[model samples]
Each structure stands twice: as C-alpha cells, then as structure tokens.
Target: MAAKLFSPLRLRGLELKNRIVVSPMCEYSSQDGFANDWHLVHLGSRAVGGAGLIIFEATAVSPEGRITPDDLGIWKDEHIEMLKRITSFIESQGSVAGVQLAHAGRKASTSSPWKGGVKVPEDQGGWQTVAPSALPFSDAYPMPVALDEAGIQKVLDDFRAATKRCLQAGFKVIEIHAAHGYLLHEFFSPLSNQRTDQYGGSFENRIRLLLEVVAAVREIWPTDHPLFVRISATDWTEGGWSIEDSVALANVLKTKDVDLIDASTGGNVPNARIPVGPGYQVEFAARIRQETGIPTGAVGIITDAQQAETILENNQADLIIMAREFLRDPYFPLHAAQELGADVPWPVQYERAKRHK
Candidate 1:
C-alpha cells in the first residue's frame, strides 16, 4: 500500500505532489516588504526539501498592516518582482507557491519577536493601528482606532488590491490570514468587537467583513486557483469564537468556494489557557472537516512522519501544515519520505544523501 503522507492532493487546478505543506511563518526579515536573498533561500530550500506547497509568511496588505517594521509587504507593485523570483524557484522544484495576505489590526506596529516584541512608538516609524473596535490587544499593546465605514472600505480595498499583486507575483495559492487574533479574527470574536453597527452585534454581522473579503478576492482571483482561509477554531475562552462558529463559518465559506480551512486556535485572547502539545490542534481540523464537509489543513506542533501519516490515514485533515518543525529541519519532507518508505524524489544535488532501505 502507498503511504498517504506522500500522496498527491488536488485543490482546484493545482495538484500537490504530497500533503506536506510549509505553513506561513513570520520571518520579520523584509525591508519595505521586498523579498531579499533571505526569503529566496528560506522558501527555496523548503521546495528543495520536498514540501508540496510552500506558503510564504503573513504578508501585510498595507504598510499599516505590518506586525513589525520588518514584516513582509505586498502593498505596492514593486514588491512583485522579488516575490515572483521566489515563486518561480519554488515551482521549479515541483512545489506550489502560496502567499498569505494579512492585516495585523491592533497587533500592528510592534518590534520583532527577537527584538523584545513590544509596541513601537510613532516616532520610531510606527503608525496608528486600526481594528473593528477601538480596543487594544492588551494593556501593553497600542489602543487601535475603531474603523468607521470608510476605514472598513479601505480594508476591503487593501485586500482586493493585495490579491491582485499576489496573482501578479505568480502565487498558485492565496491564503487569507484571518486567524491568530489578527484583524479578521478580531472582528469574528465578540471579545474584541464591541461595535453596534452593521459589522457587529450578531454572528452574521461580525463575519460580514471576512465574507465580503472572500467574495471580492474571488472576483479577481482565477477560478482555477484555490483560495484558502485560516481561522482560529476556538478562542480557548468562554463567550469567544467557538468551534461551532468555525464549523458554521466553514459551511458559509464553502458556498463562497473556499478550498480549505486552515484550522488553528487561540490567539484572539491574551491569556486563554491552551493545552499545548504535539498535534494539540489537530482535533479542531478534524472536527471542522467532518462537520463542514470542507477540506481542512491541520497545523500546530505536527512533528514526525508517522504522526502526520496518522492524521491523514484517519481522514482528519487533507493537508499537514508544519511550522516550527520546518524551521528546525527544512529537509523534513525528504527525510519523512525515507522514514515512511515512500519513493519521493530527492534533489539531484543531494541525491548522494538519499538513504537506501
């Protein structure tokens, strides 16, 4: 029997050679959103390592949407050339390239994780952050200006324009970063949105923006390409966005032609207790997949070849999105193929290292 981990999975017109995916991770290495040599090597190595799909980190749709000064940006057309270079290399390695377009909302304008990760002041190039409501992520974070109707339209416009740039950059997949307590998640969770307008105070209202964003991008995005939305299945706190909400949202997203729900949880709240462990979040992906009948991607601490294989074999998720593990070992997929006895090809340059069983 063939190993499921190495099996090809199709989404729209794109066919991934395997289920292993490099989840979008913030590198905080870009300047003015330009993809430098660091990004090329960082993403290209994963392709050489044999990941079927490599999604670039949370790329800000606008300057104000950046989480830190160094966060990647796609707000301008000039950024497309460098990104195109990276995507071309990824495709040459038989790996599909994906980009996660994001807006950090109240979490914007912070220092990099390695540099204290604190809110940067306006004098230091930081600008005012905006959210669905005028609430700060925490007392330590900046208080964001609540987006009025005009501000909301700008957000939608930013996403639409960014989607166009991603297409121009030759990205095969486009994942909307709606999870991890970002702008979209903030609107989805009542804990952050305190508005009484049409965009708040009800389930349909709160999710209005995300639905509109998907619709707008779909209009510009080719029907042959797959569109993905990452969502936090739960806030890990009472009266917050719940798994049931995620299921309901998934059902709605399916109607909008979303290809997959990248299931992740806990980031909308600062102190929501979570049971962190290997595959701790897989159950959410499994549940969302089962309930919504939409293909889901399981992320968070999914290490080891057998562990990823088990999730696929059980029909829990259609994709295994790995983050930190990929950081520790870019060649994880190549090694996994060897361990699982799957006959995956190795880069010719590194074929000498291929193990024989």
Candidate 2:
C-alpha cells in the first residue's frame, strides 16, 4: 500500500509532489527587507531535504508591518531579485516556493525572540503601529493608532503591491497572514476590534477587511496560481472569534477563490488559556474542512511521520504544515519516506546515503 503522506495534491495549476508543507517562520535576520545567503541556505536546505512545499516566513508588506525591524519584506521591487534567485533554487530542488504576505498591525514594532520580545520605542527605531482599533495587545506592547479609511485603503494597496512582487519573486503560492494576533486577526476578533465604522461591530463587519484584502490580492494574483489564507480558527476566549465563525469565514473564502485554510487557533487574546499538546490544533482544521468543504492544512506540533499520515488518512486535513519540526530536521520528508516504507528520490549527491526501499 502507498503512503498517503507522499501523495500529490493539486490546487489550481500547481501540483505539490507531497503534502509536506514547511510553515512560514520568521527568520528575523534581514536588514531593509532583503533576502541574503541565510534565507538561501535556510530555504534551500529544506528543498534539498525533499519538502514538497517551502513557504517563506511572515514577510512584511510595509516597513511598519514588521514584527521586528529585521523581518523580511516584499514592499519594494528591489527586494525581488534575491527572492527570485532563492525561489529558483527551491524549484530546482523539486520543491515549490511560497510566501506568507503579512502585516503585524498592533503586534508590530517588537523585538525578536532572542532580544527579549518587548516593545521597541520610537527613539530606539520603532515606528507607530496601526490596527482596527486603538487598543494595545498588552501593556508591554505599543498602543496602536486606529486605521481610518485612508489607512485601511493603504493596507489593501500594500497587499496588492506585495502580490505583484510575489509574482516577480517566482512564488507559486501566496498565503495571506491573517492569524497570530496580527492586523487581520485584530479585525476578526471582537476582543480586538471595537469600532463603529464599517469595519467593526458584527461578524460581517469585522471580517470585511480580510475579505477586501483577499479581493485586492486576487485581482493582481494570477488565476492559475493557488492562493491560501492562514486564519486563527478560534480566539479561545469568551465572546471572541469562534470555530463556527471560522467555518462561516471559510465558506465565504472559497467563494472568493481562496484555495485553502491554514487553520490554527488563538493569539487574538493575550490571556486566553490554551491546551497545548501534540496535534492540538488539528481538530480545528478537521472541523473547518468537514463543515466548510474547503481544503485545510493541519499545523501545530505535528512532528512524526505516522502522526502526519494519520491526519491525512483520517480525512482530517489536506496538507501537513510543520514549523518547528522542519526547523529541527529539514530532511523530514526524506526521512519520513523511509519511515513509511515508501520509495522517494533523493538528490543525486545524497543518493549514496539514501536507504534502499
């Protein structure tokens, strides 16, 4: 019998060799938003390791959209050359190159994990952050300016421009970053968005911004290429965004030409308690897929080959997206093939070390 984990998945005009997707992770190692040798080696190693799809980190669409000053960006044409080169190498290794376009919103202007992860003041080079509401994520974070009509329009324009740059950078898939307490998430959850404008109040009002952002990007994005939206399925707090809301959102998203929902939960509320464990968020993906009929990617602590296979075999999710696991072992797909007793090609240079199937 063949392993389902190694099976190909089709979306629009792209066919991934396998369901193993490298989740976008922030490298926090760039200056003025340029991809250097670090990005090349980091992403290239995963492609060489046999990942079917490798998504670049939460690349900012604007300077103020960065979670840290060092986050990768796609706001300018100058950033495209190096990114194009990196994507070429990834595709050369038989892996698809993708990027998650993002805006940090109220969550912006913070230090990287190694740098204590606190708010960066303006005097120290931090810029003012913007969000749906003027609320701050926490006392330790910066207070954000409420986006007026013009600011919201700029957000849409930024994503549209970023999509064009993504095309120039040779990305096959584009995943909009709307999760993890970012700008889009701030609009989704009532816990964050508290305005009387057209973008707040009811579920439809709160979700309006994300829908418009998708529409803007879709206009510039090629119809043949796959587009994905990563959303935090639930806020895990009272009166916050719920799984039902996510299902409704997913249903609406499919109509807008979104190909998949990368369903992970929480991050909208800073104090919400989460039951963290292996495959903790897989159920959300399963529910979204079952309820909304949209392809969903299961993420969060899925480290083992069998664990990934189980998710696919059980009809829980269409893709297995891994972050920490890929960081720990870039050759996970190659190793997983061996573990599942499946035959997969290894790079010619590494073929001698590959186990016989």
Candidate 3:
C-alpha cells in the first residue's frame, strides 16, 4: 500500500492517528517557564483539529538554557503541573503529546521575535549564555561562557531532570533539541564550536554532547514511547556543518535508540543563503533517511496536502512535521485529509464542514 499523509503509523509502542505532526514552534508566551491557558488553547486546538502528534515548542531544560525568559521550561516540578493540563486536553482529542526538551546555548537571553529578537543586555533582563566555546552567535550578541567539565555535567543532569518532568506531565514522546544553533547544535557544528577540548573539533568530539544527552534521556524515558531528535541537517555555510555530517550523525543516533530524526537546516551561522521554497529542506530528510536507514520527520515549508503526500509516497520521510502552516490552520490535518480524499475524523463542532458536500 502506498503510504499517505493520513495513514496511521506506529513508532515503538505509540500509534499515531495520522502522519501529520504539529511541529514545535516557540510561542514566547510563558512566564517563568510555565505553561498557561495560552499554551493550552494553542496546542489544544491542533489536537482538536486532528494532528496525530502535538509537539510543544522548544522548551528549555533550565533557566539559562531558555532562548528568552518567556520560553517554556521543564527544569522544575512546578512547570510540570501546567503542562499536564495541556497534555490531558490533547489526549482527550486522541492525539499523542510530545515535548521538545532544549537548551539554547549561545542563542539564549534574547528578546522574542516580536520584541526585535536582538541580544538583551543583563540590565534589560537577559543573562549570560553558555556554549562549548566562548563565541558570540554574531557580533551583535554578547560573548558566551564556555562550559567546563562541571558545567557539562550540569547540562546532562538538567536534561535528565527535564525528562523525568516530561514523564510526570504525561508526555508520551520527548524530542531533544539539537538543532537551530541551540546548545547541542553549537557543540555539533564546528562553525560555532571553536574549542580544542574533548567537546569540540573532531567529528567525534563535536557529537559528544548530543550523544551523551540522548543516552542520558533514553535511560530515563520509557521504552514504549518514541524518542525524536531534531537536527539542523546543514549549516548552509561554506566550511560549516554539511549534509554528510548529518548523515553520519543520524547513523550514530540510530544506534542510541533514537526513533526519529527531525531534519531541519541552517541557524548556525547568521546569514547563509538557504534555498527556500516549498519542501526546500525535505531533500535533507530524504537523504538522511536513505543513507542512514533511520526514520525521519520532514519539516520546512511543507504547506499543502499534495506536497506532503508526495514526500510520503516517495518514501522520503516517515513523517511530516509542519510549523507555520499549522499555525495558519490548526485543523490542518483534517483539511489536508479532505484534500487528499482520506478519511479522518473532524471535530463534532466542525463535522458539518466535511467534504461530503
């Protein structure tokens, strides 16, 4: 049977109602890293709208790991209570809830995109950020502090703590954010990591942090639920992280029991030209899945039903994760089902709008 966008897929012990996953997007609305009604409503709508999986935005594992003060946190037990409400609502609508556990690294302590997204000074409520090396993401951002052995151990513990919190919140899947110039990405990309320590330089060293984090998280995470790792498949800069490096890394992660590789690109460098268009980054997902024989989630500029279906029918990726388009239409999976002529349940409130007419 040809795999379709609305097809049910199983990874590990979880069965997705469909292949459409609402990608984690930063809402920048939390206070003190707590989830609120805004998150409940925002994520709840997608579950009602019929996404098989609802992955929350990049949630920091620690305060200093946040991209902004408003970013969601799972570092503390208090944060888990609020997240539980959101996950319960999602499950009520028959969707699996997932959380992306992340550390922003050198990208931390910035204003929200709407607030201009520039580096916020300490007096302005921004704190110093950390990275594998004391490098600035750009000249506009402050220099980051390099992580020592103690600091690195602290990071691993933070991730372990966050994973325990996710289990408490009833999340079935957890994605470790190693993409988008975040802490893990910084360590993986030589373009951002200029250190000569055991944590950087050679490919083995560059991947050390991510491998450790994944192993640590997997140790605590339930064996039944899926585990995903999002990676910027390429830096898109000359002499930077490349597709080949991603393929090699994907192979390594597969050995660590990672269930899926969410393939995305860029964000390690300031202004590398990315060839943006419909399904622009899907090729990276396809390549990695093909080369590594690991399941992958294709993301980036996938906005329509046929486009997503094509990615699946061609076996380019095992799943499709959409971001901005899902925001524009939360019930995107339901609508895409209609467009693809597949049977999908619509909210009873919206059942009258089904394609029968």
State the TM-score for model 2: 0.99
Please write out the lDDT profile of model 3 over residues 38-107, one tens digit for every residue: 9999999999999999999999999999999889999889998889999999999999999999999999
C-alpha-based local distance difference test score of model 2: 0.96
> Which one wins by lDDT: 1 or 3?
1
Candidate 1 weakest lDDT stretch, 10 residues: 348-357
Per-residue alpha-carbon lDDT of candidate 1 for residues 84-110, written as tens digits (9 for 90 to 100): 999999999999999999999999999
The local distance difference test score of model 3 is 0.93
For model 3, the superposed segments whose C-alpha errors exceed 4 Å read 1-3
Superposed Cα deviation of residue 206, candidate 3 (Å): 0.7
Query: Which model, 1 or 2, shows the larger lDDT?
Result: 2
Best by lDDT: 2
> lDDT per residue, candidate 2, 4-84, as tens digits?
999999999999999999999999999988999999999999999999999999999999999999899999999999999
lDDT of each: 0.95, 0.96, 0.93
- The RMSD of every model to the true structure, in order and in angstroms, is 0.8, 0.9, 1.2
TM-score of each: 0.99, 0.99, 0.98
